[model samples]
Target: MATSPQTRKAIADSENALRDTLWTDAADRLWAHKTSGGFVTTPKTMPYVCRILDEMSKDHPLASTYEALWSYTWANNAFLRFNKPDDVTFAAGFSGQRGRRTLLERMRRLQLLGFIETQPNGNETFGFIFLPNPHAVLFRHQAGQGTPLPDPAPKGLSTHILPASWNAFVARALDLGCKDVKLLLNPPPPAPVSAAAPAVPAALTSPKVLRRRPKAAAKA
Candidate 1:
């Protein structure tokens, strides 16, 4: 339910005026020719990575977990070389041992929601996977952007992530062209180890700070 930045700038100006009046036939032998191989290179901000994986798997049970990790990251070029034989039960179509235990419980819920990173292989526990930078892990799962989830933070697991669905996923990937992309929305906040530490106020540098839970911890 995104597409709003003025209808994604009028559908990127009607797909750049239909790619400036598309012309085709360079003696066309039926198009699909990336030097005669199947294509895989992906992110022109893939519709903001499929609406941030459908608003972060709306009430997840790994709801198709971004189409089974885009069919197990089809021959990935940018890092993420998975253990490919049988390609995790053929991308979890449910084969033997219930499709390798449902693709190892959807890659351990995409590595407990930070969207992947694994290595174990002797026992084949997701034999090598990495894939971070899901727009800097959805701006560090949004709740306060200081980045601290992954430690018993999965009981009712809703790591906020709303800021108008992260500014309509950077305004539909900068109206579909996706240059800079606000440098992946937000990341560079690490340096200050201790220049005599004491000044973090301006309302706690808010990317999120609305605390008022305690109605029995909001009836947890």
Candidate 2:
């Protein structure tokens, strides 16, 4: 059955509200981190995190999983470790939607892309620890240093390309505090240049011209 326009609008509005909530939560957490010295060594990391979250699209296959994991890590300021695959699976929200193997594969892809690093516990009873490095990933993305791995699943695949104006979005997000949220959705204009002072005319600057020829005609 075809969906009505009102239904589509309602769906869009809900999605947008969810997105806003996610970012606002991220921003608030980042502010808390800032106050608590979470970024003392790497103050630059906070902005990168905000930029990545702002640029992330809901259509990405691992968007929810990644966001959830990042939020967990950011709040705790530590790696998320699990003793069982079920723990990791549930945390990533892949219990019914996907299997543990798929979760591991997605994590491996993220690791390869520099977005995450994993360390095995060496005990079969203990699963692994996932260390998220969104700042490093954002830097690598900006520098074109790594290739984004394609998702094996057919549904909701994304190229994961960073837009050229990512920095501008980050700046606006930090300075404006979500006042003009639509600005981040659109492409940013070129860097603003200061307006130069108006040029003075040569005619105005030079001395006034004297009419000496009229006097010669009167003599003739």
Worst 10 residues of 2 by lDDT: 176-185
lDDT of 1 by residue, 20-45 (tens): 56844433544564667765656666
Off by over 4 Å in 1: 1-37, 41-43, 46-72, 75-115, 122-127, 130-136, 145-169, 173-220
Candidate 1: what lDDT?
0.60
- For 1-220, candidate 2 gives per-residue lDDT tens digits of 2356798789878886887787867444545644676442323335545445434432334544555455455345556665456666677777765667766655554555556666667664224456544544554566566566555633333325466546564564445344333333344899999999999887766655343356669899
CA-only RMSD, every prediction? 19.2, 16.0
lDDT of 2 at 72: 50
lDDT for each candidate structure: 0.60, 0.54
Error of 1 at 182 (Å): 18
